[model samples]
Target: MLRSFSYVTDHTGFCGTIKNSASDFVVTEIEVPEHLLRDTRAESLQKTSEAQLEPSSLCLQQPKKQRTEPPSPCAEGCHGGAPSPSERDPSCAGGDCSASPNKKQPEGEPELRSGLEEASMLDSLLGKPMSELLNKFACDLKDAWDLENNADAATREFSLGPILDKKDRADLHSAVRQKFPFLVTVTKDNEMIVKGNADYRELCQLVTEKETSDFFKFLDAKIENSTFSFAPDGNKEHRKVVHHFINRKFGRLLETKSFTVTDVNDQPNMSIMVRFREKSWSRKRSAGGFQEKQDLYTDFSYTGIKDKKAITYQPMVVKKVTPERLKEIGSKMEKKGMRIHNIHSACQHLRLGQLKGNHFDIVVRDLKHHSHDSSADLKERISEAMENVETKGFVNYYGPQRFGQGQNVQTDQIGLALLNEKMVKAVKLFFTPEDTDDPVNNAKRYFLQTEDAKGTLVMLPEFKVREKMLLRALNRYGVNHEGCTKGWLNIPHSMRIFYIHAYCSKIWNEAASYRLKIYGSKVVEGDLVFSEENDESVSLNDKVHVVTAPEESANKYSIKQVVLPMVGHSIKYPSNKVGQWYHERLSKDELQMCKFRVSPLQLNIPGCYRPILKNVQNLSYFLEGSEKGIEIEDNHLNAPKVSLHVSFDLDPSCYATVCLREIMKCDF
Candidate 1:
């Protein structure tokens, strides 16, 4: 049986039956009392009369004349035409009112209106049919509703003065206008005020990320009742909503905790251990769509999501770090080469009173020699190579992670566009449609590429939040690069940096390969060598040393490690045979070292030496399982039959695939 809920309010003398729709929370079927419906028509008409009489009188004066027939129905939870009493909210409007300008008034009556600051709403487009108007405002309506009811962010105590900067304030104002195209005006007086055609409280909470304390009790009560009483088989999805809010609240509290568990992918990631602090809040990875990470924690370790696929974090240990000095977090003064990106990617963490030293392991599989190779034969070959690998070492080639997956090379194209300062091309590609299965989203992307922002805005489905944001930008500002810059920049700072880094990775990989080729005469005068940097590495090189002669150069006998710069303005090119390659690459691309600048100061990957080779550690393989007739990537896996599990550990900044390639000699 489908679970349903009925609410009766003694306050409004209103009663109705509500059931959860398949779409969740939305009222699919609402049955209001017949008398209540009669009241709504009367009230809506009455408000139309009074709005013209006086704007100030809305809260203060009585109606000019009293009706002899009956009380007018309230327009409280008003959404669309002839709202049922159950949907009407008394707090919004009572008796009679026209919240929108498009609502036609009776003959010979001046227009009556309520201001936006008092309610959360969006305007219906004037002179358009109901169907067209609804389609145009579909996606934006969802955003307004989310802001108005997101109880966690809506605390009575929240305000704009404490959190937003001048730039943030301006951006928010633009966002409000963009969200509701018919929004009359946004004034700068007391924080951001969206004047017409909007829900006042919803817009306030949306921008300020706070809500009144009055709703806290109601929110808490609902969560507790729904969560504790939840049944897996219940038709109502209220329990899922409770869990979502709980997880969201928990993620916020993690900022104060010593350690936070983050969902990496298939397994628990390196973020298992971290020193949480306020400064770390600025990291791009820290915040997400559901909640701001800097938010306060009401729950610490609530693991209600039981399924393995659903839970992102696993239990891990964390310890408090006692700083010897006033350490600045989210600043560029960290011990050299300690960029935030590498820190998270390499899984750097504090251990044994110091920060990060040899503390990670990687497990790789699928190492068959050829198409028909048996599991046992592959394991024997891998075992033999492990011995030789321990002695020689694998080249530190920039693995597939550097290039991105498959033939798309989208990142490479984005990087090239960024390097050339082609902002339009870069952002256009980002919002453009690929061979995606989502036809609705793909159609919207096509509209954007064609510069039909208005068409795309209406065409978009409600869930395309990101695309809607892009279309709104193009709508407000023209559909051009100059107008679209603001929206283009809104694509998270980390994402933009990643594109540029892809280009740099390509250069680094080529240079590493070049260095290895010239190893016969390794370490000539003016040659740079690896700084013997380890996982505990942080900060930039304060001193510069150059090799003047082969004898003065230091090496670990046959180990022979060399360092290559990652193509930047501050790069140190080799003066020997390898130096020409760097100069040629830079000249061909018309890129100079001084051009590598980005926001937040830390993403600037300055000159540094990365070792050319790395040896796999604890390398071993084993046979396991079998495949009947499964297919992978359109290729049959029956021949390989799931065997040869390889386990090993590599230092930070090394790809496990490189070690595997040396052993198996096959593209993976």
Candidate 2:
């Protein structure tokens, strides 16, 4: 349990549990579009698929020899041959007179009297609107197949105008598939296309050459569009097999979209599209002023997919980092169930505080309220509490994740030691193991007892990389004050900064609570308020002016306008009682209010200010409608129920857990 953070509202918060499961807490960074990293897998997969199925056969295969004679009307049921005019019967309707074709007729259907009669018959089977649509499509199909008028007849393609209704288009597509076996249908942007076997066979040839062209294909001819489209003819399972086969062979180069196609025998099929993604490049001027291709693909790569569990993503800008180094970093992160995706070159590096904020989806379970209350009563209470939070907002305290969790030494403890210039104590605090009797801890205990860095290194688990690094440093430098300080320096700058930041956060939290308790919601004298230039979106920097005294009262600063500093040498404390409180807290820690630097450590704490109260953005909640309990680990109850799902957005660095704490009034 953590310390009780003060709340702004007077509403009584209900008791509930959070994060019983990983899914209970969901967080996503709200990044800017310009800085959004691309996912290289999508492009890489496409290229691989295309490379595997490069359309070599399509280019190599001889063009079909021009047919000398006209194609037979047998496909249109003219098996007996064209009848003489004198002998032609109106009932024949340009089809066979002597016998019915091998094709299955619609049940209880008679021979067509004419094209109109056939359409009329279809009008009864499907709706009139659909019948008319198919009628037009049939005409287009006939025109494309007409070899007499069009020289490039086989290459011709036409769309069966927009079929907006999915069911209607599907039914019509199915009908056409059965009616015209040689023709193919592909729906794009609600418009259906009718093509011939010539195109399909060319694609099949490419697929046959590259057995596993999964997502993309390369073509010999220059394609103006990025994607190459195809339709696979089969039942659902057969289509699935074809799709899986292509994916396995091509390895994700092909981009696929679902479209319905029916086989000649009226079985359903899958529609597939392949997008060929090449590295985008720019034209650069050489010394001669002539344009040359400059490869920009090497500059930018993408990482991450739309995964709920893996919600937080950040873009990193590295200079002079080799592929091998990137691979090593990726491998290490992956070992910890994390990943670094798509390392590519970029024109510029990402800057900190460039994002708007964070989005959170939180679930609170196992509600405990007044015992006799009904479900509706409980819901009302929950809603009321949430309403207060939405309207009045909660105190903006940093969550426990900022500090170290469990029984291990809190990050602030080490930070305090560093602030007090007790470098040896800080170093010891870092290596000190908890009371828990775990194998990893036992290894740490062994190191403490024997002082054999090499032997302990062997016993240390592979996952404890930081500990291993420290031990290795000690092995080289020996275990002494100077050696340990050097070992601490070996740790990453970001991590070392984190420990100090945690201490600052601790002070910020305590100061904020006291401020709220003494002043309530009123804006008082000596309170630091942001100038107009400094808003929630802006980062705390020298540019942001801290308005105090005359300006604070004149500006009518609200509680939300008040700011607290994260104690640093550069940052100014609040001028009133809250400011005095910071001095007292630092005194208790055996540190001066002014000096925050250790010259030898080569570290400086350039702190920033944060708003004491934050208004929850787009706050909303709903009751989970389930009688069954959510299965959770380490639950003593027969069935621990999850009742509420809450969602909101907060400014960057503001903790969702703290907001929930204000709502639930329960320590996590």
Candidate 3:
């Protein structure tokens, strides 16, 4: 007999079997329990199938015979066999089914997996998908901490735009708080809680999208204008307080203030007023005194007046009397021999004395009457005698006298009359020599010196009858020539004699009798004249040529040869020819004398030997021979004396010629 075996199936679809070796029998058709099969298939297909099955439908379809009894094993006999359908546990039937086997983890496994899944879901939702929550949390935590840390920090609403999602608002809030810690605030009622005073509130009202972008601009302008003052003893803390106060209270007002605070000379507690006013003040003060001051006027005076009655007379010498007091002295003189003819003469001779000082012989003429000496007869006699005469008369002889309107005796007026008859006698005796009977004899006796007289007198005779008679006599026989002739001489002899007389008379009358003394050489007719005016002891030896030329001609020819006149040992020439010789032939002294003798005629004469002539010619040989005399040898011509020709050529060449040698040797 075959040995028998048995097997059992679990809900997971895994089966267990037992076998005996002696029997050699096997349970070959072992099936899993239906409930276990259904459960396992459902778990296996869980990834694909999700719909649930009903358990009632599966139970209703079971066979009647199968339901009556469970099937048993045959005689071959396996004692434990696969359970029949009816014998399988109904708990495993399918509907929603047993939990999927793969999903049916062990006790703590499901809880642990659920816990990890929850944690992962939360991390995804909060970190990536809902990052706004994370940002909000972070911002809230920072804000709370700041509030707790700083007393000045307060919670307030801050507005983010409506376009800003939760995440953007959270991010912006965080950024704002980080950047401006004191200004950061949370939103309350959709508006930001900006921490500021009334001015800041006003600024907040002004904020827009563009204004927010430039929010720091106003702050910068305020900071620029704000001024902080510190006390002398103030420390840094005091300065900081002052700075804060200034930055807050007047932070916005400072932007509009005209003045600012600056340290002047290292002192910080000062304010500068930018707007100033101009005014003027006096620089001088009035004088002060105790007594009342007098009224000031331009014409004010101080000295008082005195009474006019106090005046007293001081006597002065109004007039003085002299020992020679002669009154009506002019009339006394007039009674003696003088009388006036006119008012002018009377005024001229008023109150004058005669005495020893002056004498008078006066005549007055009555021009209206011509009878010879009645009252006018005596006047005519005196007038004829006094004609053409200068008579002495007084003219306010005591200083100057004045007699006119408002004229007082400011000047002395002692009148004087005088008689001077000498001028009248001189006039009466005046007559030319021609008026005499013998004019030549008269001129000789009166006007001409006796021993030196040579010419006849030629008087200026009048054209009267007596002068005509004398003239006719002179025409017959010429008068002795001595003086000037008067009137016309019609006769030729008389005229000729008059001219000669006039000529000689001029010479004798004006010139001295002695001769003019001559010092130098004298020449007459190309020969040296021995002058009687010079010393007779001197002699001349050397020969000289007298050079003369016509005044209008251009050529000079030697006129004659004469001994050179010498004064002492020196030769002399005429002053007209002083410059007309070569330098070699004459010493400077002799040349000077010759130069003095050079006249303009000689200078103009061509071919004449002059010092300047050497400049125009090559006469060096002549100059040398003349200097050394004719005895000099010809051999000496080649000596250094010949070099003088070179010097003379060079001197004139400066003005005339160019040196070819020098030109050829020139570098340029």
Candidate 3 regions off by >4 Å? 1-487, 494-498, 501-516, 520-668
Ranking by TM-score: 2, 1, 3
Model 2: residues >4 Å from true position, as ranges?
Answer: 35-352, 370-376, 534-555, 627-642
Please give each candidate's TM-score: 0.43, 0.53, 0.10
Greater lDDT among 1 and 3 belongs to 1
**Which regions in candidate 1 have their CA more than 4 angstroms from the true location?**
1-380, 454-471, 520-525, 532-539, 552-560, 598-607, 625-639
Q: What is the C-alpha RMSD of each candidate to the true structure, in Å?
A: 27.7, 24.1, 78.2
Clashes of each: 30, 18, 49
lDDT of 3 by residue, 322-430 (tens): 1122233557746755332221100000000101011111111112222232342322322332221112100000001111112221111100000011221211122
Candidate order by decreasing lDDT: 2, 1, 3
Highest TM-score among the candidates is held by which one? 2
